[model samples]
Target chain A: MAENKIEIRNLYKAFGKKKVLNGVDLDVKKGESLVVIGGSGTGKSVLIKCIQGLLIPDSGSIKIDGVETVETSENIHEKMGMLFQGAALFDSLSVWENVAFVPLGKGKMSKKDAKTEAIRVLRQVGLAPDVADLSPAELSGGMQKRVGLARAIITKPEIIFFDEPTTGLDPIMADVINDLIIESARGLGATTLTITHDMASARKIADRIAMLYHGKIIWIGTVKEMENSDNPYLQQFITGNAQGPIQVEV
Target chain B: MLKKTLGTFLQTLGKAPLAFIINLGYFTQFVAKSVYNCFMPPFYFRLFGMQFLNIGFYSLPVVGLTTLFAGMVIAIQTYSGISEYGAESVVASVVLISVTRELAPVLSALMVAGRIGAAMAAEIGTMRVTEQIDALITLSANPFRYLIAPRIWAAIIVMPLLVLFGDIIGIFGGYLVGVYKLDFNPANYITNTMDFMKSTDIIMGMVKAGVFGFIISVMGCYHGYRSKGGAQGVGEATTNAVVTASILILIANYLITELFFAR
Candidate 1:
């Protein structure tokens, strides 16, 4: 397998008049956890969505395992797993079925086997096997995040994408989720890319941190490098200050 | 830059109709494939039953009330118009054929289209916005097969049944109006209704219901499948699905009526 699990080059997307994801280039290496940090609506979600072909880029090249990812085709989706910003669990499906979704239909596994495996994956994500019967609606926000993580990892995908995994939880729940994300990524030995604005969660989960601003990664380095960097945009973000080179549109 | 802008404008002008044609063709294909997928295996009898309840059974009260009042009003009006010609006895035949062959199915369709079509659009549209469709795709589930097929199948199977129910209830409403208001013998009214409605009329009406069911479900699924923007987009799709389905049902009703009854 190649070193890079995903390589996105010079991605561009625009929505009518407003430009989003202008010339974004990113690479996540195999079995590595890379976290992307950017301000809200700065195209971080759009960038990852383009990579996933949920939103196609106007012009760019996205490759997974060196296979050019204009492959929105059926063959390519089988290899991908994503944890969306909102968890995006199907309300119509039970928790265990949601986790076992891919395995049931894709692998053509019998229902009994899929259920057993769903409980196993849920347990791996620190969920009780009994939690499997509850609807996603019945779970707490943090528990939902765990279930989402369970679903994301159940398929043992070569690559996984996390969009704002820690957004809506309390600080304590956020940290728990961050730890679970790390544990899941490590357990699977999967290439993981997470986008977030939470510095604490990013610091805990990211092996290397990349800062996205104005649709470009202005700085990318180790966590230590991130703390010590002189880049103005990253500094403004890490400090959470109003007065800086970064301007929030009023 | 100016030359590029002009060239772009020209290209857009050329492409606009092409885009419309492409979308139109896609919609027709969506409808066609949905019909074909309806009868294939993994028949999801449970979901189909739930949707039958939604599309046909749950819709009974509205469809029943609407058909009752519509038949009543048609009776009242037909009596008023032809009474000058002393053709009032024909009112029974008029309301009977009208309700059975035309008004009941068409009105009930438009009503059910608003209710069930909007519900389908909103359900599927919310699913779209939340990436539930994407989730199914990732699971290697054919979303069209899972979602659209069951709904279209339920609509086809249940709509005819609903129309049959609507025809009976609506004629009863006319019977009630005719006996009480016009003093026609209730016994004569019953026989007149039986004489007026034929096997062919019932079959043709049911066939129209099936066609309308296909149109309504297809529009809802197509609009929901194409929904974008966000919740607002979903709302817009819900509204548009009803509007488009209602209009198509009327147009198709006319065409089918012409096909079955033309001189």
Candidate 2:
């Protein structure tokens, strides 16, 4: 068996009376890409946040590299990078400054050298070096997403999380982002966890697919298995049907 | 129906104090964390400079104008009030003591609380809404250290300096009114002002400035950091920061005065 890079077991999270993640258990092996598909408000984002330690789970265990993360004092995110939905770039900072934020803020590199590194990563994301000095507000939506991608991979982290990476893009732009994500993650040989309702993105990037329904993982398999599976929940989701075991809650 | 209403009312009453205590505990932890981070390494000196420029230098015009008008008005009012008893000379002393001991520090702090406190809350609250703050944490940086510490330090350092400048401008305002408007001997007015001014009074004013500065920045940061939802949340945070800072400044002014001058 390959080494599991991330292991989440019996995870549960809720806000007030609303339960988001109810006993979710999953694992991502090293260098594999896992895409979680779920409807809106089905706890996809919360699950990723719980894994990133952004939200404390109400109960259960999350182990990164076999060490329990709950209440641990270690800096688990040092090896992790994420591209937030909407890009979430610092409006106050320029492109290179945003890309170099981690190293610069941590005092690990000089500004000049960090900018140089930023330009290099921007190029890898198919952006020109001249785009380095432009503030994030100056960039278009597509360009902003590219910059966010560049920042995520700037540190060449061992694990990357992409949250709704193609939600707001056009079809062509979405395809470009999906391709870039695959290339970048493959280039670093990094493990990745992506959450999106975009099936095109999932099909293009996922090595294995999981379906989350009502805060539980209803199906887990390869893309081929997902396509061939007889699971009604997965079938209802993949077909985009409203009438099924999953209620639209409209 | 009556029982249900009574139960609901009792529950709300019971929850209010608990909620207040919880929020107070959170604010105390925030302050302790920020203070501890202020002395740690990896300090962002550039951010410190930016905050100082924002909190101190930009605040000069407002602080200067407010204190100037206050001093002039105090001089004019004192002249009219004391002249009723044929004690016109007391105008110089009254204006001098009031400006140095009360007007300069308190008024300048209130002005800053309006400007800088609201600004800090809006800026940080926007960051929170946009996920930039969470981005900082995911990037392995402590938001408190990177965001809050520098502002707190800048406010504490610059507030006293701003108040000092306000004192000078305020005293000069009094001088202008005493010399030009009241037709007093400029030399004797100057002498009475100088003779009545104590170093302790100026020091106390500056000390109050420092405390008020801390309060303004802390309230701003606390509200901003805790803000949730979106634009509406940020707006609420900015308003709360200003309101709480202004009220705390007034309350603290009384407490500090009692500590310094109560007989």
Residue A19, candidate 2: alpha-carbon lDDT: 95
DockQ of 2: 0.80
For each candidate in the order shown, give its overall lDDT on alpha carbons. 0.85, 0.92
lDDT of 2 by residue, A1-250 (tens): 8899999999999998999999999999999999999999999999999999888999999999998987678899888999999888988889999999988877779989999999999999999999999999999888899999999998889999999999989999999999999999999999999999999899999999999988899899999999999999899898899889888888
* Candidate 2 stretches greater than 4 Å from native: B84-88
TM-score of chain B of each: 0.92, 0.96
- In model 2, how well does chain A match by TM-score? 0.98
TM-score per model over all chains: 0.88, 0.97
Q: Highest TM-score among the candidates is held by which one?
A: 2
Candidate 2: residue A189 Cα off by (Å): 0.6
Q: In model 2, what is the error at residue A150, expressed in angstroms?
A: 1.0
State which candidate has the highest DockQ: 2
Q: Which one is best on lDDT?
A: 2
**Separate DockQ for every predicted complex:** 0.49, 0.80
What's the lDDT for candidate 2? Answer: 0.92
